[model samples]
Target: MISTRKKLLAASIAALLSQAGMNSLQAQEVIDEMVVTTVRMSEPLLVETDPRKPRQPLPAHDGADFLKTIPGFSVIRKGGADGDPVFRGMAGSRLSLQVDGESVLGGCGHRMDPPTAYIFPEAFESIQVIKGPQSVQHGPGNAAGVVKFERNRTRVTEPTVAIHTSALGASFGRHDEVLDASYKTPEFTVRAIGTNAAQNNYKDGDGTEVHSNYQRWSTQLSAAWTPTDTQFYEITAGRSDGEAAYADRGMDGSLFEREHYGFKGSIDNVSTLVSNIEFQYYYQYIDHVMDNYSLRTRPAGVTERAMNPDRETRGGKFAVTLQPFAGLTWVMGMDAQGNKHSDRSSMNMAMTDYRNLLRKRDAEFSQTGAFTEVSWDYNTTQTLSAGVRADRWSAKDHRSMVMLTHMMTLPNPTTGMKRDDTLTSAFVRLESQLGDMPGTVYVGVGHNERFPDYWELISKESAATTSAFNSTDPEKLTQLDAGYIYNRGNLRGSFSVFYNEIKDYILIDSAFRKPAAMMGMTRVATIARNVDARSWGAEADFTYGFADNWRAELTLASVRGENKTDNRTLAQLPPLEARLGVHYDNQTWSFGTLLRAIGSQDRVDIGRGNIAGQDFSATNSANVLSINAGWKPAARWMVTAGVDNALDKTYAEHISRAGTDVAGYTQIARVNEPGRTLWMKAQFTF
Candidate 1:
């Protein structure tokens, strides 16, 4: 029965592989360990692209599941806890998610708590990704890129404790569970995390059952205070809840509330050999709710039709850094946010009558910002970094049916009319390293200005959504990025390319026209507009280490999005994909297998639809496979198992959501990718 969360996840992977062998025995005993010399050193912190590496933990089912094993990254599935992350071709809010840098927007605007569900990569140690817009100090609508999840600070010289666990089973009725804990004291330190997941109702590959089930959980706590070694302080708090059901939306998200708290502190300089300075502050909160009795069927077997929506958001950011000399460095920042939304509906039958059928409402939003950056190094082989940012945003709707909502009157392209405006942005970059070419070369250019949310402005219907989609005007983008990196000595590589040009680009047309309500009345329509677009992409990541525990990895990505008026494509761009892996570890055991290949797009954009759309190029071509293993006996405890897909392939991924009868059309042309699954895990350390 090994329950109790698999005996506390095998005592937390036998105490993180005995703390990864006590971090290789404190790199020869932690004597002084007070190394803090700040600032300016862009790109060069890839904890593990390979180097005593052992990476492997992707066979995901949620949170865009293991980020599609990185590359350009892609995911838009609907039947497994909200999936959405299409970088390269871009996705929602131009992709920007941070944990240590605030901003984590996602509460189902048909999204359901995305933003990697507030992360839990075993209580993070690091996971940073920055693609386009080249970094403006993390925050303020990051033009199609940026991902950060960092939780560092743990170096026990005295007290210590740790734990982790896992259990998984897949195929239709899937299940998952995880738990994490940490504690280290010389002064103080603590951490805790928990997670749970479930799945059922699955059938694709010609057989349909699709209805996607779900359940979720999260909890976190952190505290740190180091009286010396320079100085330090930290505080964190968290809470999360979940529920899901949808066969392509009609309503269901039941209640996915999340509330988080934060605080941080730092200081450095022990024997000043040069100048230094640093400071930071952060905060967050989010709450959401949705309904239709969780899923929906209402026609005769009514469950008293229901609908209730709610949202509340708050954000923060602050930063400063300086090194003043020795090759120079500097950084400065500021950020702010606020939001609110509310809605209600009911017709008694299961929610117990309350004034027959009621509808409630609320809305508001705000943003503020300031930024700066600089970095230089002429010796150690040339280095440079540059940046800029400026922002001020606002919004309000005060409620009215929100008024046949649709931005308060006229036109429907799908829901996104414009009017609201106020934004500013800028960027720059350059990098080089040539001791006779072995790696490193880069360039960047950026310009962005955006302001429009709350469904691009009251779910649109036009007065341009009350003079607010563009809030009167605010939407622009111009970008270019280039890259190359290499290393030998066990091999490591990178390649990147990107291009974007968008001006007033806003389009949504999910089948226009609809107005019928009386059998318990409820009709709210939408249509949106604005156009001009272009997108381009390329990505590659590599790693190799053949021996002393074998290893190999390769990832490739491609993207294309267009709509230069009547150019085509662009309906969730994210096709061409690839992933490969082979790993093995010693001194106990660890094994792996990961391979994913996807290709096949049918091309569309017949002048933006009208019986000429819906070809998706007959979508086809998908391969996925996985296998894993881990075990550690003494030194604390650990265990892990595997088997995923392993020969049960039938693909579907186009941002997910399909299956509207015709025998459910193979659940949306068969896009269920979970068939031969199984899993096991355990861990603990103290």
Candidate 2:
């Protein structure tokens, strides 16, 4: 009975695939540095995005179109893949997503799958962003910040074996493929990654026919161990599945299974107030399936439905980093998380099975945390930082009623009850170096205390006997962030700003409307109270590389929200955007072009929205144009190409979602975005 967390995950994957081999070696120079990094030079509001160098003509199948080209990000299209990402004006679990560091929950309470939908960003290696709520180590409510996706640990000086492959094609019957492999000697190392992608049904810009199609696949495994040279260990496992089709729900995901496990360890030097030590443990699982005639075409008697939901989350963490002297540094940590959810269903077409139905668990949650941080280097251009955190949240509700149909029910309002909280967070930052011309600046302040999820505590409000998971209360946030970065010679740039204030804020009132004779239609339910809100934002980036092969770039973003408890205008924000680019290179080719512009948001209430959608009525403003080219021609090959949305514009993305007017359409339609395409990608390495 290998229990006990499966015997510590099989002794941490046997200490990360122990093999213990040691000898000086060198294999083709780490296989020519494993190529993949074509222009990455931006940082301020912390911009990373390096999914093995992919960014050109947006076909980013997931992770919200690869975080919408960075800069305050935006995405909420629901068609070809699970699009959903919005930052600055925050959304969902208040941002904070993780992948190499756990937290991967998604069993569709209407969100097909978030957590970057089981990520597949060119087999990950970079993807980081931490904007607001400054930093809190990595757990607990982060108040719109953090998005990690890492898989790195390759620093070999001998014995190496590496391989990377990529292929992609586009223009409506899109296709993609990827594989990554690694092996090393001198302690331990192993890596693996795989992916498959697909697409179909795309036509817009006056050609009609939306309703996107999709297919996906994934696999992963990683191992690391050093046993010496300062100690280190790691183990990872992964799995992924596919499904798609959704012009905005009435079911259509057809199943997407996933599972992952991780174990981490580290130690370096370790002495004098302790210097460097880290730990982690993780687990994630999800099995989803939603049906409306398996992907499309329904209605011939209708009575055919299906549902199979699942979710599980687990976590752990431990950290230490102290430098008793020299510029000072300290970090301490402890983290914990837990999650559970379950479901099963079948319908009138009589069971063709959801395993004959019998699985109901409805929510359970837990959280724990403690933290401390400090960094000081008051010399060399000044720097200072601070941090603090504390958390203890809990939840439980095992459903027993509240069905709302199938013969009307209503009681479960958090049946069996259980709710708890005790939160706290903090941050502080300051830095300077502006006077030296190389430019640099920083300022930060953050505080977060959010507690309320699982759709604002038990499916968006209503149902109290003191429970909808306990009458609200716990939102508070205060933010102020600032940034600036500039590089001299040949010019480069960055700028950032933010301001937020939210107290109690937990909005989403949809204005009731549930009884249509006990629900035959008329539906509209959103509930979740608490008000007072405010948001503000700004961003900018610029680049130029006069001659020597030329270059140009510019980006800007904006956000604004308000609803100081109902003065209106704070439901699904994100508008005013811009992007521009141009480039040229030498030594075997390179070229680029980009242009994007947007602005137009009416900000209404309409059925309300925020689990990633809602607010429409201001539409107009749109533009697009793209171009790319690259070629290495030798040295393990490389190729690139593009042509995206080049005027095939048919926009629609004000935080989408809505439109189950199926074939005859008209539920306000809207779910376009994806038309002019023409892609090409190829990569290889030995």
Candidate 3:
């Protein structure tokens, strides 16, 4: 009877396929648009935009800066650059970030260098964002969402040379330059890119200087060979280095160096059943150094200290897409990655040198995953999509001792321990077109089980154990997402909402204190613990073209989280925010203004948060206004200028890090945003 039922189901599917016309699968070409102010949602649960376009309030120097322009995104600012990105109040490993299909990890134990630090936004052609865990084609442990920085591949029919370059000058001694050059023929192509950005200390609205400054540079080279229109192979190499001063910590990053190498290839039209196959392999290394003397002056009676940490990662992926019949598609893939972390430090830089010491390996991690996704367009008005993925995660602890203070140390309880977990994730979604109103609505539910990352396991201790390596439990998340999009005559808009229930959620507590006898002193100790949590959020944006050359846009985002176990507000969550913009554009010039408002956040769980930092106190509401103008002087040549913080309002974001006392700077409650800044940019193409 089971076999007969299976046969009948197969017959019904075959009949449905017969009714739908069969055609060869082909790639769709997408044209990149220049987004000036705000990036609107192009579709339900997704956003695609060109990274090269110049936007108001100064162009982005890194990935986090660019992502903040979109709704439902915020940054945990540490200094002038290298801020961590937060989406929908979730941060750290929950948000999966990939650069050209490769995973990169930071080396800083305190998160001075996030994965987005090494990313130069203008070097990439496009940025794609997938909200919620609605798909599993990427790697595992993406309980929040996924962000991808991708480059476009173009087949050259004839010999060609193209160059796109830009330069910028801004207040506070800020300057930036970028160059992208490519040479292509029918058989092969070569491309090179370079970027430089630097800024000095900036003052707040009160004209008080903050200890924030940075300088960064990067270079990349790539070569691609194409044998046919549908087949291509590419190899890429890059390096980046920088230094930054922070106002939120005792130490500043003196060296942030990164090295990358990758290889990728793809083939299409392999057979009737298979449409395409793709593969990629990548290697990344990060070497970081932090000190109190390099970027700032040592305080009186304070010994000079420095630390060096590094991480090495190797990963690869292989995927294949198959079209078994008309209106049916399947994508299957496997990905694997491994990373090792090591560190060396000098308590007194003048007495002992860290460079001569051998680094000690602390933790190592590895993960292998397999995923399959299917999409079936059963009819013209409706479609169904679903995906399933399984991952095997393993971790090893190499620490032999744990330090409670500068002079106190004890044997590590979880030394030489190993843990493994096999987790599963899946999601299903259905979409339907609203009759003939040029609108679409969809709903989805996803379940993701996430293993603890290195920071969560090795950087902090468990509630009962000296080490969290073997005690931290994996996080399980079940989320429901729904959205609607409409595009008609003169107005376009989109709204997306999500609700999540997380079990065994890893929560960091900075207020935990160990017994004075155990620590040899009385002090707070950061620890990780599991708890139940729930969060819900919504993001909406609308744009209307009122005149031939005038348009207005409004965007709103808000999220609320609760610790169900403790019955308290979740820590480090961003408050409600809104942005309003008006723009006028014609063939020769364009002008725009942006108004941003942030609601006051009274709910707080002070001294508790994630690996980045804990919340300090409740935040007050604030508002800021900015304006920009652009002109086209000649063909392929353009110029733009803008003034940010026009009113010079002294304010700090709700998610900003607390300010620390520096030797030569005034200490505030939190790191303040830049005030009354002016910038100009020039771009040209050849």
The prediction achieving the highest TM-score against the true structure is 3
| Model 2: number of backbone collisions | 1
Q: What is the TM-score of each candidate against the true structure?
A: 0.31, 0.33, 0.94
Find the 10 residues in a row with the least total lDDT in model 2: 19-28
lDDT per model, in order? 0.59, 0.74, 0.87
The order of the candidates by lDDT, greatest first, is 3, 2, 1
lDDT of 2 at 109: 71
lDDT by residue for model 1 over 435-491, one digit each (tens)? 544567777788877665666565444433322333333557888887776654455
Clashing pairs in 2: 25-158
Q: Find the candidate with the highest lDDT and give its number.
A: 3
TM-score of 3: 0.94
Better of 2 and 3 by lDDT: 3
Model 2 gets an lDDT of 0.74
For model 1, give the RMSD to the true fold: 24.0
Q: Can you tell me which runs of candidate 3 are displaced by over 4 Å?
A: 1-35, 518-522
Cα deviation at 149, candidate 2, in Å, is 20
